[model samples]
Target: MRLVAPQFQPRTVSAFAIAVFLALTAFANPAGATSPSQTPPRASVMTVATQDRVDTRISGLHTRLQITAAQEELWQKVARVMRDNAGTMDSLRQARASNVNSMSAVDDLKSYGQIADAHADGIRKLTPAFQALYDSMSDVQKKNADLIFQTDHRHSAKKG
Candidate 1:
């Protein structure tokens, strides 16, 4: 099936770049687990693994951005938003998983809508903090940040 891509606003692109990892990871259900009842144990493990992935992404981004001591405070705000966004996505995923068996078609669609809304909301919350950090970046650091986010945006677009 051919999928139509959502048109992303330019400002949200950077926020989406940060969120793409969480969105991708949130969909990785365990192999052979086809139902909600089969998911609890695996879900717990997946939660930890997902958190690890989020942490690794945060740390990698921080390193790649070459954040200095002076930028640490602003960086912390960005990081916190990223972490919070991941947690919000994770919770929504878990809720959907737990009730999968009981959900109607409309319920399923609404659940998905909730996830999409959360993603948009996350981007909204992330943009300002990320903009502050971006503002604090040196020219070289800004270039690095641009490359990093643009790379992610391209990768995600290709996937979509």
Candidate 2:
């Protein structure tokens, strides 16, 4: 495009004619324009917890259309949410750890839910952060990030 621009630049008088022709040709039958009534699908971002890691790397995104700045911001928000819950999640893990070895079967199951609830509570507490993060994203990132996040909303801190 740049190389061709210089060659076209010298044709000052003919530029108007060329512009009108191009405009008309472009408007003749637009192939790329999306219909206004068509609704796009929803998506999310996923985080898989790896060994000794805090930052959540995005995974399982279905949409290719996203902006870089929005993606970066989404990553930051996801990281913050996970980090906020880290302490509580870790505590639950420790509790489960201490009891798992000694406890009977049903108690283990019960404790797991409690731990999950605690983790969810942590997430709920960080709701403001999540909302801010979502709001900050470019529209494209938000759309794709939705699909990615839905993959496994529970990146359970308890790999314990």
Candidate 3:
């Protein structure tokens, strides 16, 4: 699926919605367990792993939309949320990786809950901005935006 810039979609653009969507997409990826015999990667590596993927997605969306000067501010808001969501997940993953060896079953559950909560928070932050942007969009832009989000959501669901 192609990422479109905010300029392309004038009907509506919600930073919060996109952030929430991205978070949901990331979580849908099966963070499959590492083999018991396999050692986890270093913390630095663990934290850095998701950055590139997030950047690429955000960049692609921005480019495709052909965002205009007026839309730049709103686009930045969405992009920031995307980056923040990725960073939050990376931190959660890093923490889990570092503690997995010592974590109890309950601890594992708590960690998972924390990750979920963080994603929720990200969505909350993203919603208002996205809504404002979405409201400003044109009908054509809205359709394009809808298709983009729908495609990404479906793709993530399939992957999950």
The RMSD (Cα, Å) of candidate 3 is: 9.7
Q: Which has the greatest lDDT?
A: 1
- In terms of lDDT, the poorest run of 10 residues in model 1 is 31-40
Q: What is the lDDT, from 0 to 100, of the residue 100 in candidate 1?
A: 79
Winning model by TM-score = 1
Predicted candidate 2 versus true structure: per-residue lDDT over 1-160, tens digit per residue: 3324223232342322332222122112122111222221111121233212333122212133243564566546654555445534444444444445565555655564454455445545555655665577677766665544432232221221
Q: Show model 3 residue runs off by greater than 4 Å.
A: 1-19, 23-46
Q: TM-score for candidate 2, please give it.
A: 0.45
Question: How would you encode candidate 3's per-residue C-alpha lDDT over 6-102 as one tens digit per residue?
Answer: 3324236443354366654563221322223334333234344577777777788777556667888998888787777666666566556766877
lDDT of 3 at 134: 71
Per-candidate total of colliding backbone pairs: 0, 10, 17
The count of backbone overlaps in candidate 3 is 17
Off by over 4 Å in 1: 1-46
RMSD of each: 5.5, 24.1, 9.7
Q: Return whichever of 2 and 3 wins on lDDT.
A: 3
In model 2, pairs of residues that clash are 43-146, 43-147, 44-145, 44-146, 44-147, 44-148, 44-149, 45-148, 45-149, 46-148
